[model samples]
Target: MKDRKSARTKETIVRAARKIFSEHAYHTASIRMIGKEAGIEHPLINYYFPSKAELFDAIIREICEEFAASAGEWFDAIREREITEGFTEFIELLMEFNRHNPEPLRILALNLTQTKDFSLIPGYHRFPDLISRLHTLYVEKIKPMGPDQEIRMFLHSFYFLIISFLGAGPCIAQVQGMDPDGEPYREWMKATLLFIFLPRLKDINLPRAAAREDG
Candidate 1:
């Protein structure tokens, strides 16, 4: 019973901290605020988390774990498909994931762009090396869109753009007078992204790097 109670208390602290972190970002959020939100005393919170940065790191790690679980199904959907189809699956799965768990992504975006420290962005260390893996995969799977730098630029730009979308999607939809949390918004995004990128894919003309090796 004591262990169960301790586990529950830890979860409560984490949930409260997640909410507070989401609202205030990392620097501005305090242990007192998290404690208050959790309805536990600040000292008690210290027992569970030694420092505010530690708590914040914990939350970021937790979010990564959350997405890691959801990402499996996404990979399953796109694993054997054509490049464009896989891309489509990527978009759809992310959209669906956001539908259910929007807060974590918003928190991530808030930190990624808002942190003043360019040297080490907050929560930057915890993320996996997905960018490098994706880059390698693109080299093997798709034709060269341009020189290596331009292709990398495309990937990097799309990354930040997608993170922005994941974070501020509701705000953007609302600005355009649509229901941000509704199906119409989802379809609108799907159509919009495809319309913008699919044609670019053709124009960019990426040749498969694997064929170069074969030849």
Candidate 2:
């Protein structure tokens, strides 16, 4: 009973921290604000977390767990369907999650920019292995003519695609002439993914002009 109670308290603190951090960004969010939001005294957060940085790490870990759960669900869905469709479904699921969970996504982006202290986050450690697994999955699905080279290039291209979308939010808004905080932002993200991945561009044979024009 004690352990369960502690677990619940920790969860409440983490959730409150997430909300505060998401709204204010990591640099601006204060432990006092998180405590107030959680309905706990500020000192209690120190008792539970020991330090503000530790609390931030805990919240990031929770976010990572959410990400892992979403990825597992996508993989489970893929296992039940054709393997070729897995990539499309996975991308769509991610876009949908980002569209809905903009807060967490915003927090993650801020953390990436401002912090190097992600040791407590589970998925942070497994990043390399995760990338390898994703690469293998793509290679297995696409089976491009030059399978090995194509997989490498595809991974690189996809990396750039994701980085551009998430990291260049302001630039993306400028290009589309839409407010970064508006609904069009999400639509642009979805359309960008579809434009890059859905057509199986690897299989298409066309001159640079035609490819560029169509793309």
What overall lDDT goes with each candidate model?
0.73, 0.64
**lDDT tens string, model 2, 95-162?**
67766775556665555555566554323444445456655654454333444665566665775466
Cα TM-score per model: 0.76, 0.65
Write one digit per residue (lDDT tens) for candidate 1, span 1-215: 99999999999999998888878767778899999999989999989889877788788878877765565566566655655776787889888888777778788777776655633544557654545555555655554556778667666666566667777777788888888888888888888777767655534544433333366
Candidates' RMSD to native: 4.4, 6.5
Cα shift from native, residue 55, model 1 (Å) = 0.5
Cα deviation at 38, candidate 1, in Å, is: 2.2
